[model samples]
Target: MDAGEASVVLEEISYFEAVLRMLCAMLVGIVVGVERGRNHRPAGMRTHMLVALGACVTMVVSNYLFVEFRPLGATPDPARLGAQVVSGVGFLGAGTIMREGLSVKGLTTAASIWAVACLGLAAGAGYYAIALTGAAAVYATLTVFEVVQRKMNVTRHATLALDLECKDLSGVMHDLNRFSVQQNATLSHVQFDETEERGVYHLTAIAVFRGANPQADQAVFLEKLGGNLNVKKLETTQY
Candidate 1:
């Protein structure tokens, strides 16, 4: 074959290899994304897949372009591009985190996004086994570990604020304390405000409950407190 024809053939082969790498990266991303999607996470299949694909493209460009145009004495550093991918992925992860009241959410989703980017880098570097294994491990952690955590009865301390306006402050405090003790929760702080305009007493209590079922206990407490004759403006929070 002519030299020109041979060069064309080599270019075609390089293009095909890049396409293969991109496809592998995208497939790995999709696998990880599917697990997050099943859990109804914010960064689902599409987001992960795109991140992976983008990383793969960056890697391919760095590897091929640098090698082709690098100076005679200068060495090409392929890892530099991959390193940038890690930092870029952080921005995508930050997008998934959300703040709602006192509780910050989407941390897991952010972590998943970061993981998918790494998987993309692996695929781009032609490390198929490593990328696939990492994806599998991440999926297992999200699904199986979450189940184990739910079953394990882990307790976390939190402060709850409750407000009530009642005619008989002493009786209300007694009932509230009794309920807190029944659930193995503690009322660590309490404050009372009285207004002469309506002749009512406002009581705010901060309680700590076991994290395993704080919501359940709080629901029951509210139901019982709702039955009281003079209770009003009742609210609770984890802050």
Candidate 2:
């Protein structure tokens, strides 16, 4: 083949390679997203796949622009576009995070999304091994680490909000400690607020519940507190 024909053939091969990279990126995204989807996360399979695909396309386009404009002496910064992808992905990640009362949720989902974007960039850069490895690592973390975390009782602290009708703090504190001990929960801190109407006070307590079945233990504690003649209302918030 002539030189011009040979160049055209090589260019076609390169374009095909780019397409393969994007497909690999999408596959990695799907692998990561499956775990999140099974857990019913806010940003699940489709979101993860799209994020990776978008990042991969952006990277491909960035390189394409450099080659396309090279004859015109146009300089290209490939990393500049990738940097924007990293920062832009944050908005989607942030949307997955949510705060409910004292508890925060969706952190793992947000982290997974960020990781997926990185995987996409890697695939676009033709780092197939790294991208595949990252996908496996992320999936194992979401699945295996979850079991380990629960078994370890890694999380313990929960907040309890109590509204009680009481004449004195001493009586309430005594009963509360008794309830805490029985339920295997430690009362770390307590805040008291008296209502405008006399003989009513609101107590917010931060506590750490040990062992499994924290919700059951919390339920038992609430039941005991409600039985107190001085307690008009009681609720639990996990932090």
Clashes of each: 0, 0
lDDT to native, each model: 0.79, 0.80
Candidate 1 lDDT trough over 10 residues, lowest sum? 1-10
lDDT (tens digit, per residue) of candidate 1 on 50-90: 99888888877777655554544456687899999999789
Q: What's the TM for model 2?
A: 0.79
**Which residue pairs show backbone clashes in model 2?**
none
lDDT per residue as tens, model 2, 95-197: 9999986678999999999999989988887788998999999999999998988889767645555444554667888998998898878876677878887
Off by over 4 Å in 1: 1-13, 156-161, 166-179, 187-206, 211-230, 235-239
Worst 10 residues of 2 by lDDT: 1-10
The TM-score measured for candidate 1 stands at 0.74
Q: In TM-score terms, which candidate is top?
A: 2
After superposition, which runs of candidate 2 have C-alpha atoms over 4 Å from their true positions?
1-13, 154-159, 174-189, 211-229, 232-239
